[model samples]
Target: MAWQGYPALREPGGRQWEASAVAWLDGGLWLHHSLCITEREGTVDVLTLIAPCTCGRGYVDITLDSEHILMDILGDLRPTHGRFPHCEEPLDCGSVHAAPRPTGWR
Candidate 1:
């Protein structure tokens, strides 16, 4: 079946993009990170981060990976130490994997 939410697409010109998907990194034990692709638009030129806290806040939208997407998120997580701003829950980066598309994402 087609993706329920915004699905990955390939343009007639052969450019490809996807709307929302989680990006994962496995770091020995404590450094693992999960960069949630909460929002993607405009040929996937822009991406927004999903806050791991209980408030459901989102980070500033940024242009799609200039270098590497996972590296960017890993850098951002460094400041917070994987702690969400308004919530106690931490992202299960080690367990989370890049999945098929997410549900209820716009």
Candidate 2:
């Protein structure tokens, strides 16, 4: 069970490092507190966390985390403090774990 993310590689290294079984091959998540999220090829050195399952799409909504606006992500949740499942913890309906949500406020 291995997952991976990568920066854009160059020359011969590009397209040379990809997993065949979706076992952390590509599209790894990257998180930094600075502007301009620069990247490269090769999933060997990036991706914050690997997918913990084989069902595809890590954390249920990992891809949409940073892509969608918070409000959009939230949709209609009463505009109040709600509990989100934490990435490190399993999802609980009543417990309200805090999940690693995305931020596009740039």
Candidate 3:
């Protein structure tokens, strides 16, 4: 489950980050504007992203427990227009929710 060799961690450009961000976008989770691998240790990696809230005041840190699962979301998430573009109801402010594993993830 260790992701030391994951492409996102190895690559320089933001392609991998964009891909992951898009996946979250597709899954109705618009908590971040972008994602980057901030730290990698054995079976876990910390992903840092800018919050997409209208206020644009905070960052959302996501912990990937394994290569394919999202263990937790750290930091406060302000109220956004919607969790997803198509969402009719917005997510609760300052709430932490389970994020879906991205498709085509290794």
Candidate 4:
């Protein structure tokens, strides 16, 4: 499913990453600073999301992490809310939640 307005994590070269790549763990989840691409009307846009920490109870911005691998304890928190901190306006989390999962997703 496409989490519209959901922020992505980026690489140093400016590649976009998606939040869906994140995985839940015992306490929190691993927010991957990876890539996510979207196309509309033949136009493609890239977005970046702020990294979230498990223990701090808030989101943290990540940069220069070429490995793009960071793990934190999120506890019960999840990005179900389509509108992330970086969004200029609130997004419809409903649509994002309703969208179908990406191919090969377990």
Candidate with best TM-score: 1
Off by over 4 Å in 4: 1-19, 33-57, 68-106
Higher-lDDT candidate among 3 and 4?
Answer: 4
* Predicted candidate 2 versus true structure: per-residue lDDT over 1-106, tens digit per residue: 3623333323343433222222332333222221223466423322122222222224332323343543453453223222223344554222322333323212
RMSD in angstroms, all models?
11.8, 15.2, 11.8, 12.8
Better of 2 and 3 by lDDT: 3
lDDT of candidate 4 over 3-104, digit per residue (tens): 323454565656544554433333322233344344644533322334333334344433323333332212223453321234433332222222344344
Q: Indicate the TM-score of model 2.
A: 0.19
lDDT of each: 0.41, 0.31, 0.34, 0.36
lDDT by residue (37-105, candidate 3, tens digit) is 344633322343323333333223443444333312321222343221122234423343344354555
Residue-level error in angstroms, candidate 4, position 21: 1.6
Steric clashes per prediction: 0, 10, 0, 11
Best by lDDT: 1
Which ten residues in a row are the worst by lDDT in model 4?
67-76
The model with the greater TM-score, 2 or 3, is 3
Q: What is the lDDT of candidate 4?
A: 0.36
Each candidate structure's TM-score, on Cα atoms with residue i matched to residue i, is 0.27, 0.19, 0.22, 0.23
- How many backbone clashes are present in model 2? 10
lDDT of 4 at 84: 27
